[model samples]
Target: MTGTLITVAPTGAESSKAAVPALPVTIDELVATAKECEALGAAIVHVHIRDDAAEPTLDQGRLRETVAALRQSTDLIVQLSSGGAVTDPEADRLAVLDARPEMASCTMGTVNFGDGVFLNRWEFIVDLHTRMQDKGIVPEYEIFDLGQLTTLQRLLAQHGLPYGGHVHVDLVMGVPGGMPGTAAALVACHQAIRDLPAGSTFSATGIGRSTIPVILASLATGGHLRVGMEDTVTYAKGRPVESNMQLVARAVGFAQLAQRPPLTTAEARELLGMVAR
Candidate 1:
């Protein structure tokens, strides 16, 4: 917690460009978003690519191109999403590593995602972890509930440490079926994280209305922050988010106010064990 590590998840698999026109669905848009967010304060970009139709897709080619373009454009650590639309097949999801990103998201377990179930069976989780370790790709474990942290511990105990030897997690709260996005819940999650490996770091994301509350709670507890249009569309009660840059600027402002200004990309790379010491 030396400095706040702000991550920008510009676009997620669940959001639609039609619904949120500003969602970065194309490679050009994503690269632009990455550059702007990196300049604003974000050290990492948690990415989920879409097809020509602007729909969620785990296509390997598109994934590779996206990774390449982001790297060429910005210093932000590109993290691909392995939990592609709940409907993505395991093979395709696993194949995301073929893109060879610096980091990728590995959801610890499955949960009821709104109307559909975001399935992450034990075997699938193990496969994703082992593959990332093999490829030297660091993983940011996505924890939707408190119990998933326990599962993360078990995974480490059984399969050994992930590649890069650092354990980082993201608390995705306030989803319809996951943990609530409240200061109390964030504190509980923060406490539960102590059971994880020593020095493990985490970032909290509050979907929809819980966004600001979760951000404040995370900063107070010395945790990190992740923000973007992917988690929220409305910036306020009646005001819609203009773009991802607006969100990144807001996060930067918050970190500055907390006296924990955002970390640089190089610092973030070291923090995540991405660079060789």
Candidate 2:
């Protein structure tokens, strides 16, 4: 309810550099994008590392290096995506924690991701949550569907609270197999969030064309925003997104208009219960 916590996911595992040239694939590109987004009011950088060929990778060495470089370059909360690629093995995905990021994403449930299924078995979800708790890495739960909220409650009641003791989630809307990005769906999700622990916060990201609609609905509903080419390549009809900063700036403007503005890096850390480094 203070200011919006804007998180910029510069590159995801799905896009290819050959197609989305603006996507930041290399560590240098990721650093540059993180710096720019931080300056544009983004408080967190949700990262997904790529191999030399610009393809998604769960290589532990590269992941560690990327985490170190981002920490050196920017004050943004470095959050590595534990859901690497739908094809990523459970061992590799769990090993993402060895990178020791300030925070990491933990998808609550499995959902269809385009043509492939993103499998998050109950055991896998509990393992991811328990490991994050043991490692003291804060988790930004990724909810892809409505029922996932129930799964989150079950996880919390059974396992215990995540590291940092703050519960924050990212609603990934409009995925072909997930919930829609309409205001109605967002409102329903938001309503469901009330059933969570008090002070729990949520941010929403709408895939592709659902970007602006989700942004508008999130702001109107007092939620945070996540934007980047990871969720959208086309800025508008027939117009391609130029850069991640473009999306961040637009979200900042919306937050400002809503009078929520954007939270600073330190403020974000405190809000999310992240230990200052």
TM, every model: 0.98, 0.99
Q: CA lDDT of 22 in candidate 2? A: 90
Compared with the true structure, all predictions reach lDDT values of 0.93, 0.94
- Where does candidate 1 clash, by residue pair? none
Per-candidate RMSD, Å: 1.1, 0.6
Candidate 2 C-alpha lDDT tens digits along 39-110: 999999999999999989999999999999999999889999999999999999999999999899999988
Candidate 1 lands at a TM-score of 0.98
Q: Write model 1 residue lDDT over 1-277, tens digit each, in one string.
A: 7699999998998878888888899999999989999999999999999999999999889999999999888888989999889899999999999999999999999899999999999999999999999999999999999999999999999999999898999999999999999999999989989999899999999999999999999999999999998899889999989899998899999999999999999999999998732
Q: Which one is best on lDDT?
A: 2
- Off by more than 4 A, model 1: none
